[model samples]
Target chain A: MAMLFSDPFESLFNLQKALDAFHASGWLEPGPSAGGTYPPLNVFRKDDDAVVIIELPGVKKTDVDIQAKGSTIRISGTRTIEFPQKAGIHRRERIAGRFDRAITIPFEVNVEEVKAEYRDGILALFLPRAEQDKPRSIKLP
Target chain B: MVAPQELAVQPKKELTPKEEKTVPARYYVPNTDIHETDEALTLVMEMPGVEKKNIDVKLENDVLRIEGRIDFSKYEGLDPVYAEYNVGHFSRTFALSNKIDQDRIQADLQDGILTLTLPKAKQALPRQIPIN
Candidate 1:
């Protein structure tokens, strides 16, 4: 996917990134307009935390904007792709578009203390557990 | 078999390529999720926009190959304003560690996710010894 977005032509990268944003959220019904095959993935979960990893490589931390409120977390942002005028391009695919994905964490999350990290092309999020919601150690008999 | 469209679609300006890693030249991004259960491995792969008529799975030479394609050209003439997810042709291969039985592999694709049940081969299953 990174290969497709390497166009130096500003327009190509700009538009493709826009489309990719839309794709990350997913699209349906095609006719010059299509949805992305890349979905904001939901990873495995443990008792107290539910981890969500989104594959948005070639995107920078500044380009991404995220919000966590109550039990829902919303992500919205853009990954800039450069398109140089001198560079010649034969084909393009990657993606670029405004994408927003909000997940409803099964249990109430600390909302205030969620941790997020972006490395390479993957976004990893750690949703902390509320005090009362987390399991307490039971005394042995 | 490789297709022309597949080649043309993968843009040329590739990454600086940290390592010379190579995935299939032509393959679909199979939506996948792998979770380990107490007894087995559950693999859920999404292959939406693909019909059953054009999908198949084969494990040979210690490689698991899944091949399928979307017949979107049928819907061509339409203007393309945006194309973020363009999956025209697809193929993916995984090298097995020689522990799974090729014959016992079970698969099903429903609601867009292709699930393959790879039970532990006879010699790989765990056994609990009972003490008298």
Candidate 2:
């Protein structure tokens, strides 16, 4: 099965394929992160596993919650912006509120093997494909 | 039900390259919030994926420049499939007035947000009037 897929840009190909499918289905609406998703994410594939990187500046680890089930993962967190007493805001651009996002991947993930790390206000999730989702080899008689 | 759009993450803005730099790399402008109090002005900037060691805050000739270089090594060996935002260094500049106490400026980094405190000079502070 691995021999059949030799393209080094498999990840990009998959992305294009996903976009094509969305276009064909008339679901070519803007991407979830275009303006509706909090804490934009970047998905990457490495071997049979995948990693999701999220940018959540000013969010503490204690405020974030992650859950994985089958092919979908949920991330929920709250961001609080505090100002000094009697502060007069001149310019406000940074946002603060509760955020929750659920994302689905192509392959089922092994919940036991899923790991997450938050560093410098960025969250990285390592998800391994489930054993049953792996391609099985067959020999022709 | 769809959540309010304002609560979602705003699109990250890419810095427009005005001139050629020594290093050819894309840069981003971090979102910033400015607030003022009786004593000082505070600026909060969001620069995710940047560490304290990789950040530079300089004040030269009444211009304050802030830059944070992202650690690209953290992304090595990973092939991007779907990218909602690009990974790049952060750069933003602000002009300061003489009313600001340049020597008393303080900076602190916490949870990827840089907080800069610029104390006002003695003459710049608001003073109460006295009636004889």
List the DockQ of the predictions in order.
0.02, 0.37
Candidate 2, residue B107: Cα displacement in angstroms equals: 1.6
Q: Which regions of candidate 2 are displaced past 4 Å?
A: A1-36, A136-141, B1-6
Estimate, for each residue in A39-108, the C-alpha lDDT of model 2 and write its tens digit. 6777777888889889999999999999888777888878888888899998899988888787777788
lDDT per model, in order? 0.51, 0.77
RMSD of 2: 6.3
Residue B90, candidate 2: alpha-carbon lDDT = 90
Model 1 residue B63 CA deviation in Å? 1.9
TM-score of chain B of 2: 0.87
Global CA lDDT computed for model 1: 0.51
Model 1 regions more than 4 Å off: A1-141, B1-26
DockQ of 2: 0.37
Q: What tens-digit string does per-residue lDDT give for candidate 2 at B1-132?
A: 344233576877878755756554567899999999989989999999899999998888778899998777565566666666666789998887647888899988888899999998899998999998
